[model samples]
Target: MRHLHIRTPRRRVIGALAAGLLCTTGLAAPALAAPTAEPAAPTLADGLALTPPMGFNNWNSTHCRAEFNESMVEGIADLFVDKGLKDAGYQYVNLDDCWALPARDADGKLVPDPVRFPHGIKAVADYVHAKGLKLGIYTSAGTKTCNSAGFPGALGHEYSDAQQFADWGVDYLKYDNCNNQGVDAKLRYTTMRDALKATGRPIVYSICEWGENKPWEWASDVGHLWRTTGDISDSWGSMLSILKQNLPLSAHAGPGHWNDPDMLEVGNGGMTDTEYRTHFSMWSVMAAPLLIGSDLRKASDATFDVLGNKEVIAVDQDPLGKQGTVLSSEGGRWVVAKEMKDGSRAVALFNETGSPQHIATTARAAGLPEAGAYTLRDLWQHRSYNTAGTIAATVPAHGTVLVRVSAGGRWATRPPAVELGLDGSPLVQAGRTAALTSKVTDLGRTPATHLSVTLAGPAGWTVKAISPTTAGLLPTGRSLRTKWQVTAPGSTATGSYDLTLRARYRSLTGTRVESVLPLKATVVVAPPAGVSSLGDLPWLSTTNGWGPVERNTSNGESAAGDGRPITLGGVEFAKGLGVHAESAVEYYTGAACETVTADVGVDDEKGARGTVAFEIWADGTKVASTGVLTNAMPAQPVTADVSGAQVVRLVVTDGGDGIDSDHADWADAKLMC
Candidate 1:
C-alpha cells in the first residue's frame, strides 16, 4: 500500500482550526460548547478580516544565507510607512528562511546565526515596533528545513520554540514545512499549533506547506491561512497552474480561514504586466492570500500597479469574501461567474485560444434576473460600459474581460427569454437491474409548443427505453409540455452518476437550456473476492481533448503525439504537426489510455475539415472515428470518441494550405474515461 505524507505549519494550523470553530453549522448541528477554558489570545486571520494583509517576503529578493539587522528591518518599515503602504492597508514585514545558526546550543535552544542577526530577534522586534509595524519570522515544521543548510531547526522543539517567540515579542510566525517525513508531518504540525496556543501572545500564523496535502479542508481547523498549492516558481505556467488548482477549492475558504495559494510572483521578471493583472484578478476572485513575494524596496511602476489596483483589490477585500467557480467553456471561450453579496454578480470571460472570441452570459446563467440590463466595467482596462439584458463582449487571445453585473439601464440589449424545463426521474436498483424513469416538461410557464430533449448518461452504461420509446421532441401547450418514460440497464459498478437533460426551443429566439442532476443508486454486485479497495482508473492524455499546441510542421514527423519517437510506416503525426504522407496514414499516439470519453480541443486552423481524421484505438484496434471538421477557435474543447479506446490516434492531413502559420494550443486534452 502506498502511504500519503502531509506537512503543516504549527501556528497556522492552530489559528485556522480556531477560526473554523467560530462558524455555525446547519440547523441539525449539535449545540456548541462554551469556552470554559480559553486556550490563548489569537492573532488576526489575514484574509478573514476587512482588509487583505500586505507584506514583503524574503524568498523573492533574499534567499537563504542573507544577513539581517535592525537597520534592515527598520529600513523596510520606514519604506512601508513612507510609501503609505501601511496606511494603504499593508502591514507585517516578514522575514523568510535562513536566519538561524547551524545548530541549537547545548540546551536544545534555537539561536540566531551570529553573523546574520548579531543583535538577536528581540532587537529586531523592537526596531520594527519603533517603526509602527509588526515583526514576523520563519521556521520549518520538519527536522530538516527546505534550505540546504540546517539552522534554527524546530524538530522536537515545538513548545520551546513557541515560548521563545513569545518571549521575543514576535507578532507573527511564518511556519514552513520542508523536507519532512510523511507520518511526522501532520503530527509535527499539530504539535507546533498546540504549542503556539499554549503561549499567551497573539501571533498571526501563516502556514507554508507547499500544498503537498489538501490543506484547505483541515488547515482552517489549525491556522489562519494555509497554502492550497505547491510552491509557485517565477513563471507564467507555474502561476496559472497554481490558480487553476485554487479554483475548485474555493468552497473551503472564508474570512477567518483562507486558502493561501502561495505568494504573488507578479513583480518577478518572468511574466508581462497584462498577465500579472490576470494573476491578481484571479487571485482576488479565489480569495487567496495576497502576500507579496517580491522585493518591495525596488519594485517597478508596473509592479506597484499590480499591488495597488484599488478597484480589483476591492473585490479581494470585500467583507463577503467568497471564491468563484467556472460555469462553462465553449469554443476556446469560458465563462466564470462568481456570486457576490448585494444581489450582484461578478463574471469573467476568458479566451484561452489564439484568436479573438465573443462570450456572453444571461441573467439566469448568472443567477441574477429574467429581466433588467446591467452596468458593466472592464476591470483590466479600468473602463465602465453598459451591458444589454444579455452581456456580450469580445475577448482577446490568452486574455480575459471581467465585469460586475447589477440591475441597470441602456446597456447592450437583448429580448426577453423563453423558458424550458427538463425532467428526469432518479435511478434505483432492483435486484439485478438498474431502472431510470424520467419526464420532460415545458416548465417555462410560457405558451411554447416544440422542445427537444437530449439525455447524457454515465460511461459504460447502455440505455434502452422500456416505455414511450420515442427519443425526440415533445409538444406541450405554449405554457406547458411533458414527456414521460422509464429506462432500465443492468450493471454492477455503482457509485454516483450524472444525468443531463438538454432542452432546446427552436423559435424566433432559438432558446436552449440544460438541466443536470445526480442519481444515487446502489448496485448489487460485490467486488471480486480478495479485493480490499479499488484504485483509480487509467486516463489517456491525448483523449483529454485540450493540451498545449505542438510545433507546426510540414516534413518533420515522429511516431507519437507525446513528443516521443515511435515506429511509423510512411507518415507520422508528431505533436500538432503532420509529416509528408507516402501511402501510409498519419498515426499519432496518446499519453495514457483505457478511457471511454475524452475532451478533445482541436486547432483545425487550416480550415482543413475532412482533410484530417481522428481514429480511436482500444487495445491496438480501431474502435471509433470522429469525422474531420475545422473549428476556427482552437481553445474550445470538443467531445470526442474514446468510448472504448484504450489508446487513441489523431491523424492530421499534410494537404493544402494547412493552417498556414497560427499555432494550435490544446488547453486540456483529457479523457473522461
Candidate 2:
C-alpha cells in the first residue's frame, strides 16, 4: 500500500551489524558489501515505558501562541485528575513548541518565554509533578522550531539542552523535524537519543520526523515513539489519512517503541462525534500515542465521554503493547484485533463507509486465542454477548464497535525455538541490481527441515538467485542463508516497493507455520552518470526542444537522426531557434559530474534540411556552441566543462536557415556527474 508523506519527506537504509559472506576463495564479492551499523534498538531507560503513552499536547488545540501559557497546561493537568483520566492512565502534560524565547541566553541555554511561563519551566514541572503527572517538552532537529516564533531547537546544543531538560525535571521530549538540515533521520534522532541517555534522566524520546524517511523501518530503537505520518489536522480527511498511513506498520511496535500517527484531534471539533469515535478506536488498535489536542478548561461533556472511556483507554494502555492487526476488510468494513497483555484480545469492527454497515468476524479468524466459545464485551455500548462462533455487530458509518474477547481464561503454550529473520538493503537503483538475503536460526531441541523460501516484488521487476543452492535441509543448532538478485529498468521512477519475504517449515513438534516479514525498500533511479548519453536524461520541457516534449529513440527514427540510441525518448524535432523550434534537456554536474556532452544532427529520413547548431548552457548562461550545419549533415558534438555546474542544459537551435524539413536530433548526450 502506498503511504501518504503526511508530515515531512525523506530515507535510504542502514541495517544491523552482520558478518559479511566470504566466497569459496575467501574473498568477499563487491556486490555483497556489508552495510553501516543502523540505529540499534534503544536500551536507555530500558523497560521504562511498556505501552503507548497517553497525554495532552498544546499545539493542536492552542496553536502554540501566547494564549498557550502555564495556566492552560496546569488546567489540563488538573482535568486529567478531575475527570478520572489520570486514574484511568493518561499522565503526561506535554507542551509542544513555542514555549521558549527566540534565542539561547548568554550561557547558550534555552530560555523559557518570560511572558508565558512567568515562573520558568522548572516551576511548571513542579506543578505537574505535584499532581502526579509527568511534564513533556518539545524541540526540533533543526536550528529553529517549525514556527517563525524562533524558539531555539535542539540542533547544535543537543547534549547541553538535554542536560538542561533533565535539570528542569522534563520527563519526555517531542523532537520535531522543522527547518531540518537535510540530515538523515537516523543520524539526527539517534544523536538526541544518545544525548538524552547521557543526561542520566530517563526521558521518553519522541521522534517527530513526520514519517518522511519511513521511520518505522529504522527508528525502532532511536526513540520511545516515532511519528509515522505528517501533522494531523482537525479535518476528517486529515485524521483518516494519517490513520491509513499507520495501518501496515503495526509489526514494529511493542513494549518500548510505538508508532505515532500524530496527536489526536478528537475533542477539537474538526470532526463529528462518529468520526471522532472512529479516530480514537483506530489509534487504540494501532497502539498509537493517545495525546489529547484539545483545551481541557472548556471541554464539552461529549468530549469527556469519548476521552474518559476507561475500557477503551485500557485497551490502548494494554501492557502487551502489540499493534492491532487487520484481520479482514471487505466493502469498507474492517475487523482489527490487538492481543492484550492479560491474554484477552481487543477487537474492533470499524465502518469506513459513510453509512451504517454490518461488520463481523470469527474469533479464531480474528487471531483470538483458542478456537472456541468466547464472551465479547462491547466497549462503547457497554454491553456483553456470549458467543461460541462468529462475533457480529452492526457499526454506524464513520464509527466503531470495540469489544474485548475473552481469552477463554488462560494463555496458550509457547512455541519451540526455530525462527526466521530477514536482512537486506531496502534500496534498488534503476538499471542496476541488489541482493536480498534471509537467515534461519535454530535453537530448539528438534531438527527441523523441508523449509521453503519465496520472494515477490513490483511489476516490471525481476528477482532470482545469484547462485542456486540446496533447498533448506538444515538441522538443530544450524543456520542457513538464501539470496536473490533484484533489478529494474532505468525508466523506472523512484517509489516505495516492498520485497515480501516468506518462509515455511516444520518444527520439532511437527507444527508447520509460515513467517511473513515486511522488508521496506525504495527504488531510486537517476539519469545516466559518468560520460553517459544525454538522451537518457529526462527533459525539463519539450516546448524548449524541437519535437514533442519527450525523446524519440524508436519509431523508425535514428539516434542523432541516423540509427543510434541517442533518441531515447523517441522525440523527433523538425526545426531549430530560427523557425522558433528548439529542444533542451537539463543535467546536473559537480562532485559526481565533470562534463556534459551530446551529438546533434538532422535525420536522414526527412531530408533533414535545417540550419542547426549544438549548444551547452550552465545555470541559464550559454557556455558553449558548435558550428552551424544545414541539410542532412553529419551529427555534430556539443561538449562543455560542467564542473561545479548545478544545472546543465543541452540545446539544438536552428542556424540562420529557415526550417523546412529540419528534423534535428541530439544523440548520445550524457553527463559525467
Candidate 3:
C-alpha cells in the first residue's frame, strides 16, 4: 500500500527511543544508565542480513496484477540463476501482495490463493530453494492487507501466521503498514518479531511502517531493515526526494539492520538509463537493501547490466557496515563517501541539475589517510586512474560518477586528473550549429605534457574545432579552453544526444594517460508564439502523492481517468489539471514562456475535507503561491511571470495538516509565450 508522507510527534519519537532502550536492556526506568552514558544501539539477536539483503520484490513492477502468480515467481527464481544474479549475492525471491486468500482458513491460518499458487507456497518455495535461493512473503500488521482486495493480514494472528510461514519455508517477511487499528507500532512489530523467532526459522524481518513512528530511531532490534520513507515511485523527483529524506539517518544503519529507503527502480522504464545508474549507485553507497524491484522476465540487457554491476554492489555489501555520509552538498551537487572494509572509500559525485557540472571531492575530505597519490577506480566504467589527491568528474545531468579510492602502491605514480566541462546551456536546434566550449583543467601536482583534446558527437552530427585543441605543456591547476561548433542533422529527433570529450596527456613518469567524458545536448522546439493551454503541452516529468495527475478533471480516486470534471466549491471547470498534495509537474519551456496563470483550490471531490497550497516555480525559484486553500474556498487566481525561465514547474503541497483527501485542482491553467 502507498504510505502517507507525514511526520511523527517529537515527544512520541523520544519516548519510543527511551522505552526501546529500557526494553532491550530489561531494566526499570530508575535503574537505567544516566543520559550522559551513551548506550549501544540494540541490534537484532538473529545474525541474518549481515549485509543489506539482496533480492527481488514484485511490488514495483507487477503490484497485485494477475501476472504475479506462481509461474512468474518460479521464472524469477530461474532468472536469478540464469542471469548470474545468484552469484551476485541475490537470494530472496519475494512476493509482495495478493498472495493470500481474503480470509483465514478453518484453523485461523493464512491460505495461499488457490488460483495464484495452485501448488501452494511451499511448492514454490521448494522450487526457489532448489535453485539455491530463498523465498520472501508479504503481509500487513493489521487485520487486512494494504490492497483493496482486503487479504488477511498477520496482526492478531501473528503466532499462527508466523508458524504457517515457517511451515512454508519462508526465508523473509515484509510486514507492511496499513489498516493498523491504532495499535502501538512497537508493540505490533515486537509481537511479530517474537513470533518469528519462536518459529525457529531465520526469516529476515523487514519492518514496513513507512517511518510513521520514526522506526529508524528504535527499530534496530525490531527488524532487519526498516523503511525510512513513504512508498517510492519510479521517477527522478521521487527518487531524489526519498534520497534526501533517508540521507540524514546514517547512524541508524549497521551490520544486521539497515535504513531501507524502499526498493530499486532501475528497470522500471520510468527513468533514463543515466538516472537508473544514479539510482543504483546512490542506493549502493547508502548501504541499503539491494532488492531488485523490476520484473526479470521482460528486463532489457541494459537494465540487467545496471542491476548486475558487481563493483557497485560490492560497496553496498561491504563488511564494514558503515553507511555513506554526505561529504558536501551545494547547488544540487552532492559528494557522498562511504568507508570500505579494505580502507578504501567509495565516493559518489552526483549532479542533480539540468546540465553537466564539475563535482569534486578531495581524498582527505573522503576520510582517506594521507598518502602520496590515490587510485580512483570508476565503478561504472570499470577503469582505473591515479590522482594526486583530487577525485572529480564533470558529472552529467541527473547522473552520478561513483569511484572507489585507495592510496599507495601503483597509485603513487600520479596521472593528471583532467576535468572536463561544457560552457553555456547544452541545447541546440536541429540542423543548427551551436558553439560549444570545452574546458580542460589539470588538477595534478606535476605538469602534463603533449596534451591534446578532441570532441566527438553522434554519427550524423558534425563537429569542428574552432580554437586550438593541442597543447605542449599544461601546468598544475591550469585550464585549457577550446571552442567547437557542433551541428546536428536536420532529421535529428527532438531528444538528448551524447557528445564525448577525449583528452590524452603524458604524466611526469612519461606514462600516457587518457580520459573520456560524456556530455548530453538536447534539441528542442520552442513553444508557439501565443497563448496555449498547459494541458496541451507535454510535461518533462511528474510526481504525485496519490494516483497519476489527471487533465481536465477532478482528483476522483487512485487511478488515471477515475477523475471527474475539475470542480472547486461546487464550481465546475472544463480544463486544467487535477492532482493530489505533494505533487509536481515539470514542463520544458525552452525560455520562451512569459506568464503562467491558473485558478487553484482544493477539488470539491473531497467536499470540505482537503487542504492544499498551489505554487508556481520558474526554474528552481518559486514565482507565485496560493497560501493554504481548502475545499470550502472558491477558486483563487494565480499568475506568475515566468519570462526567461527554461522550465516551469507546477507544485501542490499539503497545507500544514496531513495529505488526506488532498485533492487539489489547477483549473483553467494557461501559459503565454
Candidate 4:
C-alpha cells in the first residue's frame, strides 16, 4: 500500500474587467460585474462519521488466510459485545479482501465465495445487524484487487455494485487503489460517491489511495475518510514515519472527514507496551479512525487496557472534532494540544528519544483562556491536579502523557508522578543481574506522607533493594529516588519478561493511592568469538516492506523461502540476506563485534527496475552506507566499524524514486569478533 507521485496544489483564478473609453463617442459605460460565485465543493451530506469512525477490520490480523471466515467474523462481532468494545463506541465489523469469488456471475454481479461465506454475505451481514452492529466490505477501483489472488473489483460496475451492497445490508465500503487503469483519482472516487448517493443507503466511504494524489486537498468532499500515508507495519520506525507524514496535514481534517494513518497494531507483539500506548495516544490526538486491527480472540489484558481507555477515546470522539495541533516539537520531544467541546484543552507530552525527557507547555500556548488556576487531569493515570497554567512531564522513551486542562476547578491533591529506568541495557544473560531505578516526584500542591516504593519481577526471579525504598514524607517539588538489583534465574528462557514498579503514598487528605508501571527486560545469548555469517544468527527484531527477510538467498517474491541463489548484477553468491526497501534487521552484539562486511546492491531478480540504498548502524550511529544502488549497477563491498557497539542494524531504504520493486540483497554479510 505504498505510492509515490508529485502533486501541484490547486489554485483559484480571478479575471479583471477592463473599461472602454469614448472610442464610439459613448459616455460612461456600465461597470463590469464580478463573475458568479463558484459552486460549493460537493460534500456527502449524509451526516456520518462526525467523529472518526470506531470499528474493526480483518486485514491486519487475518489477511486472506483461511482463518478469515464467517465464523471468525461472527466471533469478532460477539467479542465486540462481550468485551465492552460495543459499549465503548466500536460499531462496525468489516471484511477487507478475498470475500468474493474471482469472477462475476451470469448477470455481472459479484458472487460471495461459498467456502469463505457458507450462507453468503447477506447472512453474515444479517448476523452482525442482529447484534446491533454494522458490516463493511472492500473492493478496489480497478478490474482486480491488490492481493496476488486478484479478486474481482468495482471499476466499471459502480452502480451495480452499490446496489448490490445496499441490498446486502452493507453499511460501509473501503475502496482501494490498485490496477487503477490510469484514471483520474477525483473522477474515479467521485463516480463511486455518486453511485453510493443514488443507492439511498447511508454508507461510509473510505478512500484508500495511499496519498499518491494528495487526497487531503480534495477528498473531504468525496470520502468520509482517506488514507493519508503508506501502509503501517508493527514497528517503531514504521509508526513514527507514518506519524510524521500525517501530522503536517492537520488542517485538512475535521468533522465528517478524517485523515487515516491505517489501523491499530497495539497487540501485534512487535513492540513493547509503552510504545503501543504512544501509538494509541497520538492517533487519538490526531482524531484518526479508531479501528481495532488485532485478533480480539487472542488479545492480552494489556492490549485491552490500551484499546478500552475511555478518557483517551473521548479526546478522539470529542464533538468539537478539532484535530490536535503541535505546540512545539524539538529534540525528539513534542507537545500537542486539542481543543475540546467542554472548553478544555487535551494536551499530550510525547518523548521519542532513547531516554527520558522533560517536556513543558503553558495553558495559553495550548489555546486556553486566562484563569486563576487550571485543572490538569492525567487521562492515563486518572488523576487530577491544580496547576498555575503549567503542563509538563518527564516522559519516558517512546511514551506519552495525555492530560486535559480546564480552568476554574476546585483545588485537590493528586498522586505523585513516578518514572522507572534501567541503568544499562535491558538485555541480560541467564543467571545475570541488572540495576533498576525509580524516581517519585510530588508534583501536587501538598506533601505526600508514608511514601513507599517496591520493584517486583516475574515469579522465581529475585529483587533486592540497593537503597532506601521508603520515605516518611515527600514535599512538593521534591523527589525520592530508589534502586534495586534484579536477578534472573538460570532456567529463564531467552525472551522478554515483564517487571512491575509499585508506589504507594497518602495524599493531603490522608487517602491512600497507588501507582504501577510496567517495564520490559530481554534475555539474549552472546555471539561466539569468531567470524560468522549473519544469516546464521538470530535477529532481535525485523520489519520488511514485503514478506519476511530471507536467509541465504536473493530477493524473490513476497514469501519466505521463495528466493533463489544470492544474485546481484549477474554475480551469484551462496550465502546472504534478501530484503525489500524500507526494511530493518537488528541483532544484539553485546558490544562484542569488531567489524561487519557485506556486498550490497539491488537484487538481480527484479531486472533493472529497482533502486535502493544500504546502511549499517552500530549503537544508533550510522557506521557505513552505500549511497544509492540500482539494479543496473554491480555489487559493491561495504565495511563498518562495530567496535564497542552492543547492537548492529542493517537497513534498506527506497532510493529517491519509490519502493515499487526495490528488492535489495546483502550478499555474504559477516560479523567478526
Maximum-lDDT candidate:
3
Model 4 misses residue 262 by how many Å?
A: 2.6
Which candidate number maximizes TM-score?
Answer: 3
**Candidate 4 weakest lDDT stretch, 10 residues:** 20-29
In candidate 1, how many clashes are counted?
39
Candidate 2 segments whose C-alpha is farther than 4 A from its true place: 1-45, 369-372, 407-673
TM match of model 2 to true structure: 0.56
- TM-score of model 4 (CA atoms): 0.77
Candidate 1: tens digits of C-alpha lDDT, residues 1-673: 0111211111112222221110000000011112213222233443333334556666655455343444566677887787666665667778776667778889988888667778888888887788778877888776656555555547678899999998888877777765454434457667777888799777777776755555664566577777765555554434544555566666666666677777787787656565577677777776666767667677898888778776666667666766666666644366777777666777777654322345677656877775544556556656444333455554443456676766654333321223222332133332334444444432221222244445555565555455542323433223233333323355444333445544444322343333332223322222222211111221111111112223332221122343322112222233223222101121112223234332222333323221223333433344554443233323323344443332343322212211212122222233342
Q: Across residues 180-255, which tens digit of lDDT does each residue of candidate 4 receive?
A: 7767878888899999989999999999877767787788899999987666766665566566667766777788
TM per candidate: 0.55, 0.56, 0.83, 0.77
Q: Higher-TM-score candidate among 1 and 3?
A: 3
Which ten residues in a row are the worst by lDDT in model 1? 20-29
Ranking by lDDT: 3, 4, 2, 1
Ranking by TM-score: 3, 4, 2, 1
Candidate 3: give the clashing pairs: none
TM-score preference between candidates 1 and 4, better one: 4
- In candidate 3, what are the lDDT values of residues 1-673, reduced to their tens digit? 1222221111112222211110000000001111212212689867899999999998888877889999999999999999999999899999987899898778897889999999999999999999999999998887777776678878799998999999999999999766677778989999999999999999999998877787877788989999877667676655665676677678778899898988998898878899899999999999999899899999999999999999999999999998888877765678999999999999999886656777898999999999877788889988776777898889987789999998865764666667887776567779889888998888765678899999999898999998999889998778899999999998888877888999999887898988888887777667778998887777755666566888888767666888899887778888899887657787778888899999999887775477777888786677888888887889999999999998788887666443446788889999999
